[model samples]
Target: MHSLSKLFLTFVGFVGLSLASPGGGEDLPAVCDFAALRARWPKESCEALTSIQAGLPDLLRRVRPYTQTYVLVLLDRPDGVPRAWDDPVLSRLRVGLLADTPAETIAARYKFAQVVPYPLSPAGACALFADLHRGKIDAGLVWAPLAGYFVAVTDVENRLQALPVPQPLPPLEWPKSAWEGASASDSDLFRCADRIQGVLESYGVAPAELLTANVEESSVIPDQPPPEDLAAARVGEALYYRYCDRCHGTQAVLGRRGLELRQRFLQLSYPEFIRAIWEGRPGRGMPAYRGLLDKTQIEALYQYLRALTLGKIAPRQSTD
Candidate 1:
């Protein structure tokens, strides 16, 4: 009698699990309701997932079909040992454990093609994520630790959501001061906003509250709030690309003229990097761009140069 009962319970469990599979019983509507998923995951998890799954049918099909490829970018290098930055499993859906469905299988059903990984610096992550936000790729999978750091710095902090994964260890919580009181550098804010924007776009959240403000030249360095405002950063970038790119050559200044300038700053630390632009070395024929370039633009240039020095950006041949 005991054996028979045990067997019956086992059968029932199998049936339940089978019914929840991606294609077998009901489709579960592929998340027709975002709120329900939110209830299942943490606030951070919901934010990350919603942004990636915003345009469901297309994203599902793209990620699942052919290869089921999901692009993951780890800001830190893989030591093969799991660290706080390792969130690859949650980058997609909670699947199997959470919903009794596998993310890969769901992606397969949707026709996902491949899962690719790119290791990038914070700047590279920003550019790549920005491109993804613009629909250059399907979606970007990032580690939550870096994402949290970014959330505190960018304007998107209030606008975006951070999703928690299934069996999540514990959501990372940054000190409110990390994003509040201190004056965050422009590059820091830009990277933060880039992360927030990417997350927001993936979740299908509309950022109506976020506004783009024009950059204003200030004589004194005002005590700007933490996690610099991203909207203003972007505005400053647009202005820089339009006006300064022509003279200074923007991020990709090249030729013998450009090389000479880069060689000079190669040894300087980030602080010196800022100072050289602000105070100007003068003797090098490089004019002080401080007054003309706002704090945000200066950060962007610094980020670009830093990348170039690190060999992340290749300089073009000097025809002149």
Candidate 2:
């Protein structure tokens, strides 16, 4: 149980601290498990949990005296928290700091130990929790909400019930996008727990609750809406990257191709723009993204491209 707790903490840290790329599509910060560990163990018996939020490998030394054999699945940000690695100019960028924990650290912990870092997407995360519920792994750490979703759907027997781990540190709030608009209420949090509990119930595994929940207290960036200027630019950038970056480099598309197509495209009414997207020009191989994007997204893209035409959204000069 101690070993599992330590592993869970390490897993959460890796997910929270990754540095993302700037030009990537909309990305979410991965929600990390931050439930308390001590509540499960008799208060007097358990050692204090090492800080997972520290975002360092050396910190694992506190747990080195424990067992061995760890498979670390590096998590993508799901909570949409602002990462230190995020760029001020462009959003949605992340990269892992420590690819895998030091081999020496693993060796020191157990006579026989192995550490492998498997990067998993959100889809992969769901699949993982499914396996965990089935007793595929000795122990697993995953998003609580997802753990809940899996349990509810699988209807696994209660070999393992979801346990609520209290966080040693103060509670934190992940960004709004974390739950895809799900209100962050006690009910929502418990719903996540219920999902996991359901799965554990089905599997007949007595769910062990951790003592800590390592949630963020506040976002690195405030919750205020983007400035109008910045919002306009973001919309423009998103559209340019998604639709316009194919034929020309972003800068070239914005600075040159945009100029070339200005009058031609402006003459296009909204319906024409929609048509261009829905029905591709066969010769050009410009396929339709009608279903891929919503009306707001499409309009944002339009505003961005239009800004380019007016010379209001030129690409930054290349440092290279």
Candidate 3:
């Protein structure tokens, strides 16, 4: 307060949009707004990550202290580990690194070493040691993982070397926090934020360490709520009203007991349900949904119907 007052600097602030910002209705996480978000991004796959901005940075400052978000490390070519940070043996060697990352900042203070700032897209990862093959840098100063992946693949020829991270671990930007509360819910945003901070605490800041050529985590199946949860039945509920309600009755009420989804679900397995939707019986006046919806959407719709059938959730918003 005194420093800013001495210089007479006025502060102006701006707020960024957040998915978790609550105001309207339903009181659910934005991630649960599946149909709306998917419609907004027709071409992209839907994930809980609304944006890289996860909105934690500023919101957290008011609630708690920020933890170490990254690690800074020393990487040397197989020639061997240099004795010290001020090691005279490292003088005059080009240090290949990405600019402005923890590694670049760490390299700037080197007692005797050369630094090569590899030009790259800030949003993308670069194999830091890939430059060593260009015969330019004698040693590489970079964050882990980026170098780890490249080294994992390229070092098969025994051309590179690993200098173990010093005792305990490499110098990190801050101490890492462990993921805390997995069972937390959207009803308590702060507790949810606490869990988010834990899992993401050690995520790297440098592009190299942050991203890798090989995917560390992956998923083909779309994320969904548990079968017992009402959300799991969302797609089917929507589709039921749009296509099946008129003939089968809203909520598939027993107006036509033979057509009740609950009964049909007991008779037909999930594969049979998928097959019927994919290849609807033309003679029976049922239209195939394949032309109307993608496989994932159709699958979601089926899951929703199954939930309705099992009495896991009462039909919601059913109408004539």
Candidate 4:
């Protein structure tokens, strides 16, 4: 290992004395996992999950699923929580990390032993869990939630075990627009997990839990609702917070200026917006919400977007 990388891991371990591991149940956007990992169903039903289309270029179709395998590695540490990497428990073992994220996410701070250069959807994660349990690989790294979800769905014997990655997770994303005209090599854009879909069919299954969602609507932003749009906007605001906030962001501030809901609502007529929702822009990692949210609910979402675009509600930006 590089001398500086060794020094840094030692430093981060000191910080770990106070830091808590990330929550396994927190909601994540589609890029992390949707029907396959984390997804928020509406008050009534969850729309069926969309499959990666066979016709689209293989890279684009697998983009979202591949996104999760990148960033950090979660290893099985039975003795105690693994802190960065200097612990005697990991001294000789070649630790694993994924490359689905930007190099700087991990490379800037600490060094990892090996980065498996491939991507997987939820199904691939299942195969990996099987591999780990069967001892095909030792000292492996995996997306934390993927491990959690796999255990939840499978792992009947309770044989699988893991220690959460203790550091803060980097902001992992692969919004399709970000790749709109990409010229990067195949390896640069993604390849976060082992390539192993042929052995399992979990790729075709859904991993989302269908719960009876409970909600009454309200804006996460400043909402001085106009009298006529009041009730509808209230419901829409609730929906936005429940489903859209994770990606669109707090108070509707999306990743970039042009992609913000406030901006998109300005140019899109009601029909265009709804159509976009009905037939999601898959290239961008958004899943079609048609079955999950009904017309009435969608119409309410539009009311909220309308209020947002016209400045009826105040906008909020992400602080983290």
* TM-score against native, each model: 0.23, 0.26, 0.28, 0.34
Which candidate would rank higher by TM-score, 2 or 3?
3
Per-candidate total of colliding backbone pairs? 31, 58, 5, 2
Arrange candidates by TM-score, highest first: which order? 4, 3, 2, 1
The lDDT of each candidate is 0.34, 0.34, 0.39, 0.40
**Worst 10 contiguous positions by lDDT, candidate 1:** 62-71
Please, what are the lDDT tens digits per residue for candidate 2 over residues 251-287? 6443222334455567776656655654334323233
Task: Return the candidate ranking by lDDT, descending.
Answer: 4, 3, 2, 1
Residue pairs that clash (backbone atoms under 3 angstroms), model 3: 68-174, 78-161, 95-114, 95-116, 233-304
Q: Identify the runs in model 3 with alpha carbons over 4 angstroms from their true place.
A: 1-83, 120-127, 164-320
Error of 2 at 294 (Å): 1.7
Task: Say what the RMSD of model 4 is.
Answer: 19.9
Over 1-320, each residue of candidate 1 has an lDDT whose tens digit, in order, gives: 34323322332332342232223343222122233322433343223333332221222122111121122222211222111124343343221111112222333443223443322222223333433333334333443334332333331212223222212122222223212112234443334334433443332221212112233434444343224444554554554443333234444444223534456556665556655555444333333343335565666665555555566555434222
Error of 4 at 66 (Å): 22
Error of 1 at 281 (Å): 2.3
CA shift at 73, candidate 3, in angstroms? 8.8
In candidate 4, clashing pairs total: 2
Write down the TM-score for model 1.
0.23
